[model samples]
Target: MQLIDSRYIMASPEVVWAALLNPEVLKDCVPGCESMTGSAEDGFEAVVAQKVGPVSARFTGLVKLSDLDIGKGLTISGEGKGGPAGYAKGGAKVTLEPIEGGTRLSYEVEANVGGKIAQLGSRIIDSFAKKMADTFFERFQTAVEGPAEAEEGTDETQKKGWFKRLIS
Candidate 1:
């Protein structure tokens, strides 16, 4: 599978870069992430529990960053095992560009999987991948924006609930 996309973050490149490299931020944003550790210089380890259709697995992987240009770009590669579920390996090249009052982040990622997970079907895996990416970005956006603005921009249905509480 391959994914290529970009997002505009409401922060400076430095702030966005700092959040990207922070394990705590990633752990909070990554879907199904049970744990993540290490650093950009020493490589990072992650454990994630993911499910697709009727198949579920716990993946443990190590990711390394290379050719880093500090607050600009980097190359990432990693592989993970899902025990009896399967194994996956992937790489990505990410670039950050300063845009307007914020930062634009882009990445091109390619990955392959094998074992029982592969047998489940590519469509399922592809959908899961897209969903995971969406969830990650949404969480990252919320984290950077903070909770006050998040609540202010809540959907109408959600706003009604909060309005009732405020009035009560």
Candidate 2:
């Protein structure tokens, strides 16, 4: 499946770029990431657990950063094994552009799955991929720019992500 999306972050391109290479920020922002280690130059190893449709699995993967343009953009690609559940591999081209007050972070992602997971069908897999991409960017934005302004009359505690709310 393929997905494209973008978000405006209230930070400079440099700051956003730094966060993208930060292992702590990535570990915290990735929806189900349990741990991540390594550097942007050497690539990272990550363990993540997630549930998609009726399948649940823990994935161990290696994520690499390439096509570097300094504070401008890069490509992140990775593949993971989920035992019998399936395997997933994908790549995303991320771009950063300075805007009026911050940076416009955009991404185009393409992913493929195999084994039993692919049996779930494209509709289910597509929706899950979209959600994963959305969640990652949302959490990344929050991590870089801090908590979003609480909506009027909305309880601050209603914010998503248990860890994010706790830290905020």
Candidate 3:
């Protein structure tokens, strides 16, 4: 599958970048994440338990950050095995742009899956993936923006633009 999207975060690029590289922040934001360890410079290992439809699996994975440009952008690639459930490998290209009062983050991702999980069909898998992505971004936004801060005004503008593009 391929995914492309963008979000405006109510923080500076530097702050968002720092949060992105922080293992604790990732562990907190990633759905079903049980543990995350290792360094940002040397690829991290993750254990996550996830359930989709009637299937459940525990995935152990290693994620590497490459083609990094610090606060600007990076490439994230990972592979995981879920025993009888399946195996997945994916990569995403992430870019950060400084906006008026915050940062705009964009991503293009490609993923592939196989084994029992692949038997679930594309629609089910895609829907589940979308939900997971939504949850991940929501948590990430909360982590970077914090609870005490005001909601970002840019979010509405961007949403409207996206809707317009979708309808057009």
Candidate 4:
């Protein structure tokens, strides 16, 4: 599956770029990420547990950052094995552009799966991939910008609605 998306984070490109390279921040942002270690220089080793469709598995993998352009962008790629359930591999091209208030974080992702998990069909897998992407970006935004809060002129209901759109 392939997907493209972007989000405006309420932080400078430098701050978001630093968070992207921090293992602790990434661990918190990634869904199902149980443990993550290493650095931007050596890459990271991670253990993740996730359920896609009816398949549940723990994936031990290595995630690497490459094609660096300093604070501008980079390419992230990783592959993991989930025993007999399946193997998953994907890569994303990420770019950061400074916008009016903060930065525009954009990504193009491509993913593939195999083994028994592939039997679930494209409909299920595609939806799962899209959800994963959305959830990751949402969490990333939150991590970089902190929790959502009502703007000066916004009411409680407006804040609630904005938060709802963020996570959903």
Q: Report the number of the highest-lDDT candidate.
A: 2
After superposition on all C-alphas, the RMSD of every candidate to the true structure, in Å, is: 6.8, 4.4, 8.0, 5.1
lDDT per residue as tens, model 4, 1-168: 999999998777887788788888788877999999999989999999999989999989999999999999999899989999999999889999999978999999999999988999999999998998898888888877767576688664222222224333
Worst 10 residues of 3 by lDDT: 158-167
lDDT of 2 by residue, 80-144 (tens): 99999999999899999999978999999999999889999999999999898899998888887
Model 4 Cα displacement at 87 (Å)? 0.4
TM-score of each: 0.83, 0.88, 0.85, 0.89
lDDT value, residue 66 of candidate 2: 98
lDDT of each: 0.77, 0.88, 0.80, 0.86
Cα lDDT of candidate 3 equals 0.80
Local accuracy of candidate 3 as per-residue lDDT tens digits, 117-136 = 88999988887777666677
Q: Tell me which of candidates 2 and 3 scores higher on lDDT.
A: 2
Query: Which candidate wins on TM-score?
Result: 4
User: What residue pairs are clashing in model 1?
Assistant: none
Error of 2 at 147 (Å): 1.2
Which pairs, if any, clash in model 4?
Answer: none
| Superposition error at 148 for model 3 (Å) | 5.8
